[model samples]
Target chain A: MQCFSCGFNAMPGSTSCGRCGANLSLAKAPIPVTPPRAGAVAKRILPGWWALNRRMAPLLLRIGIGEAALPALAVPLEVVVRPLIAMVQRPVSLLPGVPFIVAGHRAPGWLLLAVWIAVMLLALMLHGLPVIFLLLVGGAIALHAASALQATGLAYRSVGARLAGIVTCAVMLLGLFYLPLGWGTMRIVGGGWWVVPVRVPASFPPFAEGDIIWLDRSAKPNLGDVVVTFRPQTLRRVRALAGQEVAMIDGVLLVDDVPSPWQSALRPLAEGVRFTVPDGRCFVLLPESYPPGGTPPAPTPQPTGGWPYNRQPMWTVVVGEREIRDAGGNWLPSLGSIEGRIVGRSYPLSRFGRIE
Target chain B: MPEDEDPQPRRAAAAATAPAEKDAAHWLRLADEQRRAGSHESALRFYSRSLEVDRTAVTGWLGQVQMLVQLGEYPQADVWAKKALEIFPQHAEILSAGGQAKCRMGALPEALVMSDGALARPGESAYRWLVRGEIILAQRERGDDHCFDKALILDRDWLVPLEAATACLFHNAPAKALKRAQEAVERGPTSPRCWFVQGECQQRLGMDSAALKSFSRVLELSPQHLEARGRVTAGGGGGMWRRLGRLFGGR
Candidate 1:
C-alpha cells in the first residue's frame, strides 16, 4: 500500500509508513464527521419553490398579509446584478457642465453660478413655489460634479498635473471641512430661526417695515422681552412674567405696583386693566402705539367705530392665563399662540444685531 | 273635480317629477353606499357622476373633496372645494375641507382663516372640528388637543378619536391618550390602527402584559406588520433585545 502522507510504497499490513514514518491506520477513519440537524439540512438542500411554499403556505390561517411575502425576504441574486449592470451601462450624468469646467470657460461657470444665486434670492424674496429650491439644489450638484470630474481628468494629465492635483486636493479638503460646518449650522438654527421681512404692523417703531428680523424659539422670553403672537397677528412685548401682578393705570403700565422702563415706551394705556399673571402664563402688551394715530407711528391704519373701536385699545394688553383675553373680550388664541422672541434683526443692515 | 283637470297637464307634471328625482340625487346615494363599503375609488367615480349630472350639488362636491384628501391629492381637493364655495359661498363643510387641504399644502395662515370661518358657523360636524384640530396641530399651537376633544364630542364613532389619541401622545399627555385609545378600541375594534394606538398607550402607561397582548393581536391580524413584529421579537425573546435596540435608535 502507498503511504498517504509521502506517497511511498509500504509493506503489506504495516501499521506505520516505512520512509515517511506516517500512521496508515489513522487514515482509515478521517476527520470524524457529525450529521447536521434535520431542519438545517432541509434548509440547505430544499429547492426554492418547495422552501417558499413550506415557509408561506401556513399563512392561510391568518387574517391579513401574513407570511405570504416571505419569499421576498430571500432576495434573488439577479435583483442586485440587474441594477449594477444598468448603472454601469448608463451611469447617472451628474456632471452636466463638464465641457465648460474642463476647458476653463469661466463665463459658463460664472453664468451657472449666477443662476444658482438668483434662485436662492428669489426663494428668499417671493417665498413662492418651493420647486425653485429643488432646481437650485440640482444646479449645485451639477456644478460640484463637473468640477470634481474635471479635477480628476487634470490630475491624470502630465502637462499641468502638479497644479491641477493641488487644486483638486484643496477642493476636496474644503469639502471635508464643510461636512462638520453644515452639521453645526443645522444644529444651531434648524427650525428655530425664522425671518420676517415686512414691518409687522404690530412692531412698528423698533421694527420698521422692510426690516428683516430673526425669531429665535430657543431663547426663553423674560419680562420685557419683545415677542410675536399670531392670534390677531400682532407683535407684543412681554410686560410681566408668571405670578406678577400687572396693572395699567392712566395710560401707564405697572408691574407689581412698580412702573418698569417699558412704561416709558408705551404710547398710553387704558385705565383699570388689572391682570395678575397666573402660573405658566405671562402678560404681553402691544402698546397703544399700534392704533391708527398712536405714538411711535402706527404701521397700518386701524378701523374706526363698532366693536373694534368700543372694546379695543390702540395699545392692546393680552392677559395670559388658561386662555389669552384681549381687553377681557371673548377672543382666545388657539394653543401655541406665541411664536417666539425677536432675538436678532438682519434686514436693516444699519442696525444689524441683537434687538434691545 | 279631478276630471275637470286635463290628463295631459297631470301627465306632464308626473314626467317632470320623475326626471328631477332621478338626477343627481340617485348618483349621490350610490356614492354614499360605495364610500360606506370602503370602495373609495368607486365612490369617487360615483361622486363625479353626480357632479356631472348636477354641478350645483354641495354634497357631491364635499364627497369628492373628501376622497381627494384621503388620496393625498391636496391641490385637486382645494380646487374642488373652491368650486363648491362658488355654489355655496359660506358653506361650513366646504370651508373646512379647503382649510385642511391648505394646511397640507403649507398655507398655514390661509388654513387658519378657513378653519376659523368653519368653526364660527353653527351646527358644525365632527369632520370640521377634526380639520380644525389638524390645522392647529400643524401650526404647533398649544392646546390643539382640546380641538380633538371637541371633534370626539361631536361624533365618537369615527377615526377622529384615534387621531385625538395620537395628538394626546404627541403632547405628552399619556393618560388622556389612553382614554382616547380606549374609546377608539371600543368604536373601531377591527382596525389595526386603533389596536396599534391602544398598544402604544398601554406601553406608555407601563402596562407591559396588556401591551404585549395588544401587540400580539396586531401581529395575528397582520403578520407583516413590521413594527408589531419588532415589539414581539424584542419583548418575547431575550437575545433579540440587542437587535431591537439597534432598530429603535439605541445608538
Candidate 2:
C-alpha cells in the first residue's frame, strides 16, 4: 500500500510513513519530495573539506586562536619531546616536520611550520626574559596529539553528540595540553648557560675598550655584567627588563628616576624621554640617535663603523612575534623588532610604531 | 458555490504526491505520472507534449531537462536548458537543471556559473540549494552536509537526503554517501527507498552486515520492493561472503 505521509510503497496496513515519518493513516496526502514549486533537480553530492570548514566556522572561530597559539606549546613541550625529536632527527630528519603533515599541509605549509619550529627553538635556546616559544612549536605537536586524543575520547563520551560536540570539547582543551609539558621543561630543564664574548670599547671605567667579556645566556644581568649582545660577533646589555620605566634626562640615563649604573653611551637627543616597557619586551639604548617627526626614519642593519658607537637613547624593543615576513615570504630579523625603529617599514608606523 | 469553487490546487496538493491526478493540467500530469513510474524516456515525451500544449509552462521545460539528465542525455538536457533559458532566463529551476546537466557533462566551471545563477534567482526552493550543494560537491570539497541540511530544513522530505546520498554514492565517496544515506534513514526509517539507498551506501562502504540489515529492512517495509528482494536473494546462502569480498568494486 502507498504510505500517505511521504507517498512511499509501504506494507498495506502500515499506520505511518516509513519514508517521511508522516502519519500514513491521517488521510493527509504525503508530501513527497515535491518542490514548493514544480521543480526538478537531480542527485545530491557530499561536501568537501573546504565546505566543512565553512560549516564548522563557529567552533573554528574560538579554536583558530588556540590553534594559532598551538605552535607556542612546542617550546615548553619540547622540553619533554626534545629527546625523541633530537635523536630521531639525527637519523630521520623528516620527523620534526611531521606535525605540519598531520595537521594537513605539505610543501608551502612546511615553510611556515619550520619558521614556527624555529621560533619555539629560539625561545628555548635564547632563555630571554620573555620565554613562551617553548610552549609553542614543541607543544604544537603535542597539542595536536592531545587534541586528537581529546577528540577520540569525546567521541566515545556518552554526553557528546557527534563530531561537532567532540571537536568543540577538544578545542576547549587546546591550551591545557601544554601546561604539564611546560612544567616538566621548567622543573627539569631548570636553566642553562651561554658564555658570550664582547668588545666593550666605550664602557671603559668598568673595563677597557678592547676587553673581552662573557655573559650567561640564561642569567638576568647584574652590576658589572655587560649585556649588549648580538651573538658571537656582538654583546649587548639588557637595558631594562619588561616593567622598569627608563628615561634619559639631560644626557643622564635614569632607571625609575634613579641614575643608572650599567649605562651604554647616552645620546643627546634623548633629553627627557621616558616610558615604561611592555611585557614580552625590553627597552634597549639604540646604537644611534633618531630625528623626531610624524613620518619615521629608516634604520640600517648595523653601523660598519665601530664604537664611540653613537648611543641613541631609546627604542621600545618588542619581541618579533611570528608576523616577520616580507611580501615574498622571507624571514625578517630573528632578533626582537624594535617597533619604534624605522627598519624598512615592515610594520605600520601608526600601529606598531616606527623602528627608529 | 464558493465551496465548490474552493481552489483546485489545494485538493490537488492533498493528493499531489500520488503521481497521477484525475483532473489536472493534461500533459503535465501525464509527465509527472511517467516520471513517477520510472520511465524517463516516456516522461521526456510527455514533458515535451506538455510544452507543446502550453509553451509558457516552465514546469514542462524543467521536466524535459530533468528527464533528459535522468536518461543520461546530458547534451540534450543542456540544449533544452539553453532553449528554456532563452524563454525564461531568470527561472531558477531551469538554471539549476542546466547546472546539473553541465556538471554531468564534465564542464565544472560552466556548471558552477549556472549553479550560482540559480542561487541568484529570487524563487527560493529546496531544489536550488540541492543543486548548489551538488555543484560544490562536484568541486571535490566535502562540506555540503550543511547545504543538504539547509535543503531539508526548507523541505522536510526524506527524498532530499536520499538524493543527497545518491549523489555522493555516484561521486565515489561511499563513506560520506553512507552518512547521507543514514540521514535519510533517520528521516524515514520505514521507507523502503530510504532503506534501499542506505543499503547501497553501506555496501559501497564494505559494511556487509549493515548493508544486509538495511536490505532486509527494505523488504520488510515494502514487501513488493523487487530490487531489495533481488539483493536479499543474490546474497542468500554462500554468495554473501563472495559478494562481500568484492569490497572496492562495491560502487
Candidate 3:
C-alpha cells in the first residue's frame, strides 16, 4: 500500500507507511482495466447508430444518477433562489433606507416555491434533451472529482458540500430557463389543469364524478363558461356576463330578458332580486344541491333570526333553487369572485376531452 | 347601595339592621352580599328564599333569573322569567331578563318582542340594552351593533360591555366583540371575563400570539377559569406551565 500524503510504499501487511507515518489504507488503489476480447478485433468498425448507442449508454447511466440525485440537491437551491424571486417581484428601491421594492401586485411567496417544485418534477419526468444536459453536468462533476483526487488522493468525503455549489448554480440556470418556457406553455394551454372529483349528474350533464378540468386563469369568462370561483370557492356555469341585466324573481333567473334553462331546474327562494351585472362582474349559476359530489348533506348551523330565513346549508344561497341571495341575503357571486374558467377535462382516459 | 333614597332603598336599609327584619328585602340584601362574595350557589339559595318569602319581590325575581343565566341553566332561567313576567307583566327589567333568557334559548322572535317591550319602557338601564343586543344578535339583525353601543353608553361600569362582548363572540362577530372587549378591559383591567373575551376575539381574528397572551393574562387574573386554561392549552402555551406544575408536584 502507498501513503496518500507522502507517496511512500508500506509492506503488504502494514497499516501505515513507516517512514512518513501516514495511513496507507486511506489511499485509493487504481481501478483495473479489462482488455478487449480477441474476437472483437476481427469485426469491422461499428455502424453509426451502434457507435452512437455506445457513446449514449454511459451518458444515459450518468444522467439517470443525476436525475435521481436532483431532488436531494434542490433543497439548498430553493433557499438561495427564493429570495431572488422575491427581489424581482419587489425590486429594492435605491432610495436611502428602503430595502424592498414597492409594487401594486405582489406574487404570493408560495407561488415561486410551487412553480419551482413543479418545474423540477417536470424536468425529472422529461427525457431526451435533459439527459444530454445531465451528461454535460456529469462531465463537469467528473472534472471536479478528478481535480479533487489529484490534490487529496482520496474520494471526496463531503458529497453535499462539494457538489452542491455547482449543482445549485446549474439548477438555478435551468430553473430560469424552465420557468418562462413552462409559463408560456401554461399560458397557451390555459394556466393549469384540475380534477373535479364531485359528480353533479343532474345539473352538469355529460360531466360526471372524478373528471379532470383545465383552467385558463387569464381567460375572460363568457356567458356559457363553466368557471371555477374563489372566495366562497365553487365551480359553476356562468349564465350572466358583464353588462347584462340579471333578475331573480321568486327563484327564477332572467338574464337579459331570457329565462335561463337553469331557472326551470332550480328552485330559487321567494326573493325579488334585480341587478345589472356591474362592470367586471358576471353571475355564475351554481347547481341546486351543493357538494357537487352528490355527498350527503353536511349539518350546518341555521342562520339565526327566524326559521323563515333558514335555507338549506350551502356556500351562497340557502333559499330554494330559485333564490339568488346568500344566507346573508347577498346577491350572486360577482366576476371578481371567480378564479378561472374550466377550459376542459383532461383526465379519465375514457372521457378525456374539452369542457363546454 | 341602591342608586336612589327611595322607599325600596329605605326598606332595604331598615331590613339590614332591624332586629325583627324578617322579610324579602332582608333576604335580598343577604343574597346580594353572597353574590358580591363570589358564592354564587349560596347567592342563588338566598335569592330563592327571598322569592319564596315574597313572589312579587321584583328585585328577588330578577336576582334569581340573573343567577340562573350566569350558571348556564337557560331552561330554568326561562321558567323563572316566565313566572316573574306573569306577576310583573310591564316591568322593564323583568322583560329584559326574559328576553335575555329567550335569546340564549334560541327563541329569537319571542326574545325580540320582549326586548322591544323592555326598551319601550321608560327608565331603561344598561341591562335592558344588553338584553336587546343579545336578542338582535339572535335575530341576525344588522342593528345588533347599535344595540351593543347603546348598552356600553348606558353602562356606568364595565359589566354591561363585558357581557355584551361575550354575546358578540358567541354570535361570531369577533370584530365587534373585540371593540367591546377592549372597552371592558380598559374599564376593568383585572376582570377575567374581559380578558377571556379579548382572547376569544384575538383568536378568531388570527392573532394567535396576542390571543395566547390574553388567555394567559386571563388565567393569571382568575386561576380557576377553566375556559382560559383550555384556551391556553389549546394554543400550545400550557406545556411550560404543566412542566412547572409537575416539578411542584401539582396535577
Candidate 4:
C-alpha cells in the first residue's frame, strides 16, 4: 500500500508507513485530495510547470537527473531573489544580519543586507534609478548559501521603532550603511586599491559606459598607461613623462619629436605647439574614442556587473586637456594629482589594455 | 526565508494579496495544485502563503517541507521538518519527511532510525510505508519490496505502484522496478505517466524494442509528450507509432 502522508510504499497489510513511519490506517486523513484542476489558478498561470513536472521532472528523475525544469529555473529566485523581493514589502526589518556579517571580522552577507536597506531608503527618497541599480546589484549577490549564526553582531537597532518609506529610509540608511561603507572605502584606500563606478564622455577611450575603474593606487604612472588624476579629475593616458618634450605638431602627437600615438579625439591645439613636460608632471591626454564592437575585447576577469557600491566621483571633464588651453596651453597634470594607474581589470570590454 | 531569518521567521503579509482573500484552505488547495502542476517553487510559495494565513495548518507545513525536498533543497527540507516536528511532535508524516531528507543526505542509518520512529507513532498511513520503502531502497539493499507492497496494499492507487517503480529504478534495481512499472500499467493502462515509467524501466533493463513500444504508447496517449516524441522520432519505435510520430513531428 502507498503511504499517503509522504508517498511511501509498504507490504500488503502493513500497519504503518515504512518510509515515514506513519500508521497505515489513518494515512488518508492528511492526503491533499488530488482534484482535477480545471481552470484553476495554477493551471492558468503555469501550464508548463504542470505539464513538465507532472511529466518531464519524473522522467528526468527516473533517468537519474533532477526535478522540474521550472523549479530548477526557479531555485535561484526562491532561494536568493524572493527574500530580496520580500525585503521590500518588509513592513518590518527584513535584513537583520542577512547580507553583511562575515567570518569573525566581517562578512559579505551582512554588508549585502546593509546595501539592500540602503537601497530601499534611496527608493523611499525617490532616487529612482540609483535604487533600481543598487537593488539589481543586491539581487545578484543573493545569499542562499549564507552562514546565519555568525551574524549575531547585527542586532544594533534597538533604538527606534524603524518606520520609513524609501526616502527617509534612504537618508537613515545612508548613515547606517555608510558606517560600514566609510570604513570599507577607507580600507580599500589604505590597501592601495581603489574601485569606482565611472562614466566618461563619448570621446574618452578605454572606459565604457557603466564601466567600473579598479585602480592600483600604488603603481607609478608609465607612458601609454591610463591613470586617474585628481587636479582636473579625469582619466587620461600618459603620453609624455617628466622632462619629455611634447609637441602638437601639425595635429600629430610628438613625444621628444618622435611620432607618438595620437590618443585624444579632441583638438587641444591649432598651431604647432611645443612644450617641455615639467618635472613631477606628466602630459596627459584623453585616449582616442573607442568604437563599440570595433576591437575584440581583452579577456579580463571582472565582468560588467561586479561587486557594486563604492565612492563615486562625478565625471565632469568632457575634454580636460582643452580646458588648460587658456592657462599657457600645457595639459600637464602634476604627478601628485595622479592618484593611480588603471589596472587590467578596469571595465574589460573596451580598450583599457589597448592604451599601452 | 529560513536561509537568513529565524528557523520559524514571522512571514510578512504580501502587499498585493488582500487580507480577506488570505484563506489558509484556499492557499493549501493552490499549493497542492501547484505541486501537482509541477512547479515545486510555486507550491513552496503557496504553502508559505497558507502558513502565513494559518500557521497551525500542519498540511501547509508538510507541503512546504515536501516541496523543498522535491526541489532538492534537502538541507532546508531537514531544517523545516525539524521546525514542523517542534510544533507537532510525534507527527508520523513529519518524521517520514525528515527521514526522506536524511536518506537524501546519505545518512542511511539516521534515515532508518527516523523511519522506524515514524512507524512507532499513532498516525498509521501509506505515506510512512513509502518513506520506509524509499529509505530501504536508498540503502542499496533489495529487501524493500515488502515495504513497497505494504504501501501498495494500503493505497491501492496506480500512482503508488508507479512511485514504487520509480523508487526501485532510482535505487539501481531495474528488474524490480520493471515489475512494479508493469503493475502500475495494469492498474492504470491509459495513464501516460505509467507508460512512460514502463518505458524508462524497459530502457534501464536494456529491453530497447519494448522500451520504444512503451514510449510510443505514451505518445499515443499524450500527443504532447515531448520526451516520448523524441524517442519515437529517433527510431526508438516503429509500425503505427512511427507514422503517428511523423504526423506530429513532421513539421
Candidate 5:
C-alpha cells in the first residue's frame, strides 16, 4: 500500500509508513458505510435552545429514568458513572484552601442509623400487610391516576414531563433506601472506620489469623533473621543466609561445617545425602509436611549399590521432631527446608498463597 | 625471519578483533553513563546499541525501558517493557516498570491486573507495591481505598501511598489523608515531596503548627519549593514569620 501521509511506498496491507513512520490510515478520510440523509445534510445547526435541549434530553432521561432503574438493574451503573463525574468535577472544583474532604458529603451516622431503622420498620409494616391488600392499594392508585389523566387530557399534553417526574421520584426513593445500606456495607467491607499500618517482621511465619507482620526492610537483615519471603510454589523456610556454606549431609543441614540445629529435625535422610550450598545461595525446606511427633513408614531395604541409585524413604529418620502432620499422621518438612527467608506477607490474607 | 612473518599475521588478527571488543565496551560504558546522567534518550540509544552487539544482554533491554519511563515516553517504554517481559516474564523489575507505564497512560484497570500477575510471582520488591498504589489511585473507584491501604500495609516505606493519600483527601477523607501522609513521612523522612504531602494533610486537618513544621522541612530539603513557600505565606499569622525565618536560616 502507498503511505497516504508521506506518499512513501509500503508493502501491501501496511497501516504505517516504514520510512517516515507516519500513520497512513489516519491520513486517509474515514469511509462512511452509509451516506447522510438529505434532510440531515440540509439543516443548518444552531447552538441555542434547540441544540441544548436535544443534547440534554438523553442525559436528563439517563439521569432521571435510567439512573432510577439502576439500583434494580443487573449492572452497577453507579460504579461506572460516579468516577466519570468525579473526574470531571475535580478540575472545575480546584480552589485553593478549600479542603478536599468536602468532595462527597456523607450522611451523618445518626441520620443513617435513623434511616435504617425507619426503613426496617417500614419493611416490617409492609410485610405485615396482606399481599392482596398491597395489590388492591396499588391498583386503586393506578386507576385513579389513569382516570384523572384521561379526564383532564393534561397527561397527554405533558406525557414526557409526567414520566420524568415519576422516574425522578422512583429513583430518589430507591437511592434513599439503597445508598445508605450500600455505603455502610462498603465501609464495613473496606475495613472499618480506621486504618492502621502494621509492620510485618521479616521472620514472621506464613499467614495465620492475628499474626502482626512488619512489612518494611529498613534495617539490614542478619543471620538467623526471621524474614518474610514470598514464594509461589510452596510455603517453606530459609535455612541459611547468603554467603554461608550450606551443605546437606544425607539431608542433615550444615552451615559452614557446623551442623545447624535444624539438621537434627531432618535425621531421616542423613544417611545418603550430602550437597554443598553454593555462595550467594541459601538452603530452604518446607514446613513440616507430616504430623508433629508422628513416625514415618520404614524404608524398604535395597541392594547397597546399583547403576541407578535406589530411592530410599528418608521420612523415618525425621519423624518425631517438630514437623507438620498430614491427616494420616505423617511427619512433614519444616521451614528450614525452603529456599528463601520470609520478607513480607502478601496483604488481604485472601490473596496470600503458599510460599514455595 | 619466520618469527617476523608470524608476528605480522598475529598483529593483523588482533587488529581485526580489537575493534569489535572496543565497540562493545564503548556502547556498554555509554549506556551506563547516560543512565547515571539521567539522559534517558541517549541511554536508550546506547542500550539499543549494546543489545545489537549482544542480544542476550538482558540488562540492556531493562535499561532501555527504565530510560523510556524516565523520559515520560510511555508508549515506547511500554513496547520495550513488553519485550523485556517476553524474555523474562517473571522478572520483578520488568513487571513493575511495565505496570507503572500502563498506569501513566491512564490504563489503570489494566495496570492493576498486570501488577497482580507480577505479585503472583515469587520474590518482588517494594517498587511493585508502589506501582500498584499509583494504579489504584488513578482508578479512584470505591474499592481503591482498600488497595491503597493494602499497598501501604505491604510496603510501609513506599512514597506512593503519600501521593495516594493526597488523592484520598481530594476524595473526601482528610482524616485518612493525614493518617496516610504521616505514615509515609515517618517511613521516608528524607523525601521533601513526602513532607509537602504531610503539610497539605496537616493543613487540611487544621493543625497549623504541624503544617508549618512540615512545610519548613520541605523548604529545608528543597530550597526552591515555591508552592510550599506560598503555603507558608497563605497560612499567615503571628508566629508564622518567625517560623519562616527559622526555616530559611535567617535566625
Candidate 6:
C-alpha cells in the first residue's frame, strides 16, 4: 500500500503510515464476512471486551507509573509559570526626548523599577531548592489525590490535569493582581496627562478648527471689531478701520484729509464700494492684497456735492446696544446680543497637539 | 407505517430544538400586544422575557419601568428607572419619567436633582423645567424656601413663584412675597396665577385700587380663576360694584 501523505510504501495490513504517521486503513471499504447467529454474537461481544483489556493493560500500566511523565509535565509547568511571574515584574518605559533625570525622581519610571525589583526577589526566593522541590512534591501529591478521588467517581480527571489547572489559575490570579497597575504606570509615564481638562470650543460650519485668528481687546471695540467679529461668519479678516464718515472716491478710502494707504488692500474684498461706519462705529476694510511697488495710483480730485461712492451693506456696532449683524441686515440672535469680549482662545498649544 | 407513527415524539423534538434567536422578537411583539390589551401584568412578563434575551434593550427597559409606574408598583418602578438611567444617563424621557416617579414617592429632593441633570443637557424641554418647579414648590411647602428661590432663578418662567408668593402673603414676610410675585408676573404675564399673585400682593400692601384691578383682569382672562375671585369677595368689593356701575351708566 502507498501512503498518500509521505508517499511511503507500507505493508498491506498496516493501519498507519510508519514514515509520516498518517492513517491508511480508514481509506478501505468495509467487507462483511458472514451473518452472525444470536449465541455467537453474545460471545463475540464478551471476547471483544477481553481483547480490548488485553491490548490496553500494558499501555495503562506504563503511563500510570511512568518515571518520564512526571518530568515532562514539570518542564512545561516551569516554562509557563516562570515567564508569567517575570512579565508581572517587568519595568515600564517613560517619555521620549525629556531626559529621565530631569523629568524627576517621582515620575512613573522610578515607581515601576521598585516594583520590578521586589517581584524579582520574591520570584527568586520561590525558585530556590527547598521551594522548588516542595512545589514538585506538592504537585505530584495533588495529582495522586485527584486521581484517587476520580477513581472513587467524585470527578472524571486525574491529578495531573488538576495540578496544571491550579498552576494556570495561580498565573492568572497573579496577572490580574499586577497587570492593571503595570499598565496604569506605563500610561502615566507615556505623558498623556495634558489631555485631562483643556476646554474645546464648538465648531461652526465653513470655518474649520485650524483657522488662525488675531484677537483685539483694546477699549470699546469700534466698527473695526464688528468687522472682525463678522469675519468669523464671512471667513475673512479685516485690515483697515476707516474712520466714521470716511468717503471712498473711485475705489479709494479717504479719511477727510488723507487718502488712506489701506484702501488698496481693501479693494480685493469689496471693490468700487463705499460704506459709512454708523455713529459710534468705524469703517473696516480688508488688508491690501497687492503690494505697494511703483509710485501709487495718482489721487483723483474729490467730487463736491454728490459723493462719488456707493454704500455697501456691512456690519455696524451700536455701542450701548452691543449688537452685531450679518451683511443681509438681519439679527443673528443665538450669538447672544452681548458683545462677548475676546477673553481667551481655544486652540492648540503645539502643532502636534489637538484643541481639546 | 404512517398511521402507526407517533407525532408526539416529533413535536417534542421540534420543541426542544427551536431556535432561541426568535424568542426576543416574539416576546417583544407579545409585550406590545398585551400592553394594547391593557394587561400590564402580562405585558411586564413578556417585556422582562425580551430583556432577558438582550439585557441592553433600552426601549424594553423604559417600557417595563413605565408599566411598573402605571401599576403603582413604585419600589419596582424606582429599580427599573435606575437601571434605565445606568444604561443611558442623558436620555431625556427616562430622566423626566424618573423625576415623576420620585415626585410621586415624595422624594422631592432626589427628583429635583434628577430634573436638574436633565435640564443641563442642551435644548431640554420646558416641561421638564415645569416639573422641576413642582419639586421646588414641594420643598417650599415643607418650609425650605431656599430651594424654591433657586428653582425660580433656574427657570424664571416657572408658575410656582406665584403660588409660593401667595402662600407667603399669609405665612411669610409681605415684602419678599410682593417682590417674588411681581417678578413672577413680569416673567409670565399671560399666566392667570401671576395676575392672581399681583392682586394678592397689592391687597397685602393695602393698595386696594390696584388689587381690585388685578383681580378684575384675572377674572377677565380666566373667569373661573378661584383664588382671585375669592380674594375679591373676601376683601369686600362695593368697589367692584362701583366699577361695574361706571361701565354701564350709573357712575
Best by TM-score: 4
Worst 10 residues of 5 chain A by lDDT: A33-42
lDDT by residue for model 1 over A69-146, one digit each (tens)? 322321121122212222233333113343354357778766755664565454343332246546665555555545
Indicate the residue-level lDDT of B129 in model 3: 82
Q: State TM-scores per candidate.
A: 0.32, 0.36, 0.34, 0.42, 0.28, 0.21
Model 1 spans > 4 angstroms off: A1-356, B1-43, B49-55, B163-179, B190-193, B196-212, B215-251
Residue A163, model 3, lDDT: 61
Error of 2 at B129 (Å): 1.5
Q: Sort all candidates by TM-score, best to worst.
A: 4, 2, 3, 1, 5, 6
- Per-residue C-alpha lDDT of model 3 across residues A20-39, encoded as one tens digit per residue: 45444433333111111112
Which prediction has the highest DockQ against the true structure? 2
- Tens digits of per-residue lDDT for model 4 on A15-82? 77676565665433343322111223322333333223234333544555433333343332223222
How does the DockQ of candidate 2 come out? 0.02
Model 4, A35: alpha-carbon shift in Å?
Answer: 23
lDDT of 3 at B167: 76
Q: For candidate 2, what is the DockQ-based docking class?
A: incorrect
When just chain B is superposed on the true chain B, each candidate scores a TM-score of 0.62, 0.78, 0.73, 0.75, 0.52, 0.41
Candidate 1 C-alpha lDDT tens digits along B8-115: 977899998988876888888998777644456687778887767765456777888776655545545776787566545657888999887665554555667898
Residue B81's lDDT within candidate 3 is: 75
Q: Which ten residues in a row have the lowest lDDT in candidate 1 chain A?
A: A31-40
Q: Residue-wise lDDT of candidate 2 within A322-341, one digit each (tens)?
A: 21222101111113332111
TM-score of 4: 0.42
Error of 2 at B63 (Å): 2.1
Note the residue pairs that clash in candidate 6: A143-A159, A223-A282, A265-A287, A265-A288
How large is the interface RMSD of each prediction? Answer: 36.1, 17.4, 46.5, 12.6, 17.7, 33.4
lDDT, candidates in the order shown: 0.58, 0.53, 0.57, 0.60, 0.49, 0.46
Candidate 1 clash pair list:
A199-A209, A251-A269, A287-A315, A288-A314, A288-A315, A335-B141, A335-B142, A336-B141, A336-B142
* Predicted candidate 4 versus true structure: per-residue lDDT over B130-179, tens digit per residue: 88988767655566888988988888778778777866765557888999
Model 5 stretches with alpha carbons more than 4 Å out: A1-356, B1-77, B141-177, B202-210, B221-227, B234-251
What fraction of the native interface does candidate 3 get right in terms of contacts?
0.00
As for candidate 1, its interface RMSD to one decimal place is 36.1
